[model samples]
Every structure is written in structure tokens, then in C-alpha cells.
Target: MAPGGNRGWLLRLVIAFSFAQGAVSMARPAVSYRALALGADERAIGVIAGVYALLPLFAAVPLGRRTDHGRCAPLLPVGVVLISGGCAMSGIANSLWGMAVWSGVMGLGHLCFVIGAQSLVARQSAPHEQDRNFGHFTIGASLGQLVGPIAAGALIGGRDMAGTSAFALLVAGAGGAVALTSLWHIESRTTSKSREEQGERVPVRRILRARGVPAGIFISLAVLSATDILTAYLPVVGEHRGIAPSVIGLLLSLRAAASIACRLVLTPLLRLLGRTLLLTVTCLLAALLCAGIAL
Candidate 1:
């Protein structure tokens, strides 16, 4: 079959991705609450949360490189397993260190799934259809992000914070497992067969030196750092302010919904301002938002 010839695979991929991302979304806040119930302070929470991204940061490039040379299908299931296990294990962990380790595992799993899924999309879509396919792909993530927190909030709360949070994590693991049902034949067999790959790998230095690469990386890093800090710190902030877990969850859901809204409007924004200006303006606004949040 020609790339993008059949739409069924795309639908399945989106469904699976939704479940996978939903699991991570639900687990993130649950992890924070569980850590707090186990006596974690703000600093401790920060460290543990930071560890979630640390493993992925170092592992993503290598994983991407491997995907470039091999089939992308295998990583998807491996990622799902790791994410589910990490969530369930983190629920049972009694100490901060153990939670941190499991959180890192979760992050690594997410990285794996993303790299594989993205590579799959790139390989399966025609050049002209790439933009639309990617847009559809991201909507799956948005759907997951939008729903996960609400579900988490609905489940986690009450005097037994630890118990409730642990329950939520277990549920998240189950939710991740749901993705496996959608994974049947998600990858195209044509691409999975080993063939002689064209060209040598691009040198890291040369790639980094390419025009706009640094700027794009820095922008992504900044936005990601802000988002991560917000997710990891919000529950602590809520505890300090006496806000309820449900309310925090609602706020997080609202934030995600706003992100979805932004994506919906992105085409118009790009048409009006073009990519460079739009990115610049958004980055500036993001910096201001982060500063305000800090205050």
C-alpha cells in the first residue's frame, strides 16, 4: 500500500496514542500528590519531578537514531509497558527516591513512544499529506491531555491522600494498557522490512550549526521547562494555598484546553503573521506568563 493510502491505521494510532498520553497525564499529578503524602517538601518534589525529564533528555537522541535505522513498531509496545509499570510502581513506592526512579522510567517510556510514533507518521505519510496528518496526530495528544487530569481529579482526593493518589496511579496504568488493544498492525509492514538505509547520519555539530536550529531548540526548551515546572509545582502550590485537588485538576485541564484552542487557531495565526513572527510573539508572551506565574 502506498503511504497514507488507508486511513484506518492512522485512526488506530491516534486512539492508542490518546490512551498512552492520558496515562502519563494522569500519573504526573498523582505522583506529586503521592510524593507529598509521603513527606516530600517543595524542593524534594522539584528534584523528583526533574528526574522524570532527565532520563528522556539523554535517551531521546539515541532512540531517534535507532529508529532512523530500524523499524519503529517495536518501540511503541516497549514504551507502553514501561509507562504502565512505572505508573503502577510509583504508586507503591514508599520513598522519594523510589518515586523519582519510577518517574524517570515513565519519562523514558514517553520518549520512546513519541520517537517511534513520530517516525511512523513520517514514514507513512506522503509529503503533501504530512501537515494534515501531523495535525491530526497532535489532536490525539490534546484529547488525552484534556481528559486525563479531569479523570485524575475525579478519582484523587479526600483525607486518605496517599491511598487516593495511589489508586489513581494504578488506574492510569490500566488506562495505558488500553492502548495495547489498538496497537495491532499499527506499523506498516512495508517499512518494517530491513533495507539499506540511505546516507550517513548527520553529525551532531553540523545539525546544531544549521540555521534556526539553536533558536528552535531554545524555544522548545523554554516552553517545556515552563510547562514541566507548572505541572510539578502546582499541587504543592495548591496545598500551600489550601486549594483542593479537584480545583487544581480543573485548572490544569483548563490550561490544556487553552493549548488545544491555540492549536486550532494556529493556521490562521500562521497565515496572518507567518511562522517566524508568530513564534517570536508567542515566545515573548510565554516569557511574560512565566514571570507572572513566578510572582
Candidate 2:
């Protein structure tokens, strides 16, 4: 929608997303390491990590509904502020509860950023263009996931675990703020929103009843939860085994790199094996690898 249908906006959006997502990716492991240094048991660690997800579950629907009616740019800055504040505060928080509270705030900020970003993509693209644009947009997330853990590892895993981890978190806060640099003029004021949709919202029951919907949701949940579990707990596992944080970060980067590679080849793989077969094979492989990691 630029003067010549330029996609400069998409590139800037991707850059902003990379920084935002990088901060979160870095913060998650730093939080775990930081919690461990605070004398938190694995139980406490789980509680703190889980809180990062809990608030977002309750907040996303309302936030989405709100974004549906308003400009998406506002949420981006708000989200950045929350993410930055939460990361910085968590670094300084001495108490377990304080860390948990800040973690939840970061999670909510993440949800806000993602929903707003995705909605902007949807609203800006035509139906025929949505697939390509969305694909390009998700590449930002992959880039962040690939880089963030390495940076965190470089900063953490010192003899002063508490201090080093806190420093990493502070750095992540600064990284998140960098996203604000690209957010200017992100939403076009000329874009109108007063028009109504063509139809009423579909009933939840009907959506649930649709063939493949529940199954697809379950598959996505399984995949995403596995990644989250690794991000939050791998450092703990590394600690138990006396593994270096840098090594753990390398492992995570490897995981992310594989994910990006798979996405790059997804279309060709889909064509070669078809969806059901690809799903089964990928799930089986993932289960085996996960079991190996456990051992």
C-alpha cells in the first residue's frame, strides 16, 4: 500500500519482530538460570515459567477483539514497553513471586505483540497475497529464535550465575526496546476500518465440530508446547548434568535451525509425502529425538 505497492513496511515489521522475539527468547532461559541462582527448586522454577503462559491465555481473546476494532500500531508499542519493563524488573526482583509476576507481564506483552502483528498482516494483505506475506513475516520469528539463545548463553553461565543471568536479562530488555525504532508509521492512517464484516462471527460449536479442526489444534499444541518446554527447562537439565549454558544454547540454536530448514522445505515435503504422512513421520521423529534427549 505504499506509493508503488512497495513492501518496505513488511521488511521493517520483520526487523522489529526479530528484536522483540529475540528479547523474549533470550529472557526465557535467563529467567530459568536466574531463578536457579535464587535458590529456586525445580518446582518453583516450573511455577515461575508457567506463569509466563497463564495470563496470556486469559488475555488473548479480549485483546484480539480490541485489535479488531482499533489500530494495531498502538498495541506494538505498548507490548514493547511491557516486555522491556518486565525483563528489566525480573532481573532485579529478589523474590520468587516478583519474578513470576514479571514473567506473566512479559507473556501478556508477547501475546499483545503477536496478535497485533498478525492482525496487521491480515488486514493489510489481500486474500490472494496473505499466504506469501504471512510466510515472510514468520521468518522474523525464526531468525530471532535462532539468535537469541546464543546471545543469552554468551552472557550467562558464569561463576556468578545470579549476576550474569541478571545481566543477560537486562540486555534482553534493551534488545526489546530496539524494536521501537522500526515501529514508526507502521500503520497507515489512510487505512479505514469503519466497514463491517460480511457476516456474523461463526459459532464456536460449529468451528469445533468442523472436521480436522480439533485434530489440527491438538497437533499444533503438541508441537508448540514441546518447544516451550525445552526453552524453559533445558537449562535446568543442563545444570543437573553439569553442562555449560553455552552448550545448552548451542543445542537450542540447533533445534531452531532445524525448524527453519523444515519450514523452508515444507512445500516440497508436503508435495512429496502429503500432509498426513508428513505429520506422522515428523511426529514420530520428534518423539524419538525427545526421548533421546530425556535419556
Candidate 3:
């Protein structure tokens, strides 16, 4: 089927993605809170947070290569399983070390899901439709990010810090599993990877030097790093200041809501300012705002 023919699969994909991402999002802060309850010092908490990024670092290329050669649909389930297992296991873990390990597994699962999702988007979409499809996909992610923190905030926090946070993690696991329901038959059978894609690997350096590639990568990395830092440390900051978990969650959700608003307005904004200036202005504003938050 042509990419423009039916968009129902896209909606389903977004819903499933939201659930998976929400599970991860909720687990992030809950992990931090639970770590604190497990007698973690600042350094230990830092290590655990860093683990999420580091664990997925080396696995990207391999997973991408696999998707290039095989099917993308299978990776979605693998991701859901890993995410669910990580969240549930982390809840039961008694030590920072165990939490770190599970956190890595969780990160890997997320990487798998993203790789699969992106691959599916490329395979199933015509070039003209690619931009809109990607935008829609990002909205799904934003929805999860926006809701997850609020849910975490509501479920965590109380006299029994460890117990409450663990409960939240368990809940996240169940939420992740819910995504499985929407995963059935999302990928088009005819959209399998082309023989050309299955052949030789593109030279990474050549691709990186292509027009707009480096800048796009930089922007994506910058934005992602900022959000990851927020998810990892915001709750810790709240804990230190004696802030309520629900309040912290609200703050995080607002950030996510702003992200969604930006995505919605992006097309018109791009037409007005053009891509370069739009990116420049937005990045500057983000830098200033994030710095203010840090202070």
C-alpha cells in the first residue's frame, strides 16, 4: 500500500510507542528515588543515571544493522520485553548496582524500539510523506514523556520512599506491557528492507559529512542530552529541596508539553523563519532556559 493510502497504522504505532516510552519515562525518576532510598550517595546516583546512556552507546550500530537485514516488527516486542523486565527487576533490586544493571537493560530496550520504529517509518513511507510521519511519531513520544512524569509523581513520594518508588516501577512495567496490544501487524509485509539496503554498509564518515547531516545530528544530540539530564536529575533536585514528587512531575510534564507545542507549530514556524534561523533561535532559547533552571 502507498504511504498515503491509510494512516491507521500510524495512529496505532503512536499509541504503542507512547505506552512504551511512558513506562521508561516513569521508571527513570522512580529509579533515582529508589536509588536514594537504597543508601545511594550523589556519585552513585550520577553513575546510575549515566549508565542509561552508556549502555545503549555500543548497541546502536548492531541493532541498526540487524534491522537493515531483517524485519523491524520483531524488535518492537523485544524492546517491550526488555523495558518491562528492566522496570520490574529494578523495582525488586535492593542495591544501586542492581538498579544500574537493570537501567542498562532498559536503555538497550529503548534503543531497540527506536531503531525499529525509525526503520519502519523509512520502509513504509514515501519520501514526500516522511517528514509528516516523523513529526507524528515524535508527538507520540512527547505524549508519553508528558504523562509519565506526572504519573510517577503521583505514585511515588511518601514516608516509605523505597516502597513507593518501587511500586511506581512495577506499575511502569505493567504499562509497558500494554503497548504489546497495539503492536500486532503494524508493519507492512511488503515494506521489508530492500535488497540494496541489505547489501553493503554505507560509509559512516561519508554520510556524516553530507549536507545538513552534521547539524541535524548535533541538534538531535543536544536536545536529547538536555531531556535526558532533566529526567535523570530533576527528581533528585526536588528531593534535596523538599519538593513534592507531584510538583516535580508537573514541572517535567510542562517541559514535555512545550515540546509538543513546538512540534505542532513547527511547520508554520519553519515557513516563517526557515530551518537555519529557526534551529539557531530555538537552540539559544533552550540553552538559556536550561541554564536558568540549573541555577
List per-prediction Cα lDDT, in the order shown.
0.88, 0.87, 0.87
lDDT of 1 by residue, 1-295 (tens): 5677786778888998999999998999989999999999999999999999999989977888788786677899999999999999999999999999999999999998989988888777888999999888887788888888888888888999999999999999999999988887666453542446546778788999999999999989989888888888888888888989898888888889999999889999999999999988998998898678667
Error of 2 at 136 (Å): 1.1
TM for candidate 1 is: 0.96
Q: How many Å off is the CA of 173 in candidate 3?
A: 0.6
Clashing pairs in 1: none
**lDDT at 114, model 1:** 87
TM-scores of all predicted structures? 0.96, 0.94, 0.93
Instruction: Highest TM-score: give the candidate number.
Output: 1
lDDT of 1 at 2: 68
> What value does the lDDT take at residue 169 in candidate 1?
95
By summed lDDT, the worst window of 10 consecutive residues in model 2 runs over: 189-198
Error of 3 at 240 (Å): 1.1
As for model 2, its CA RMSD to the true structure in angstroms is 1.9
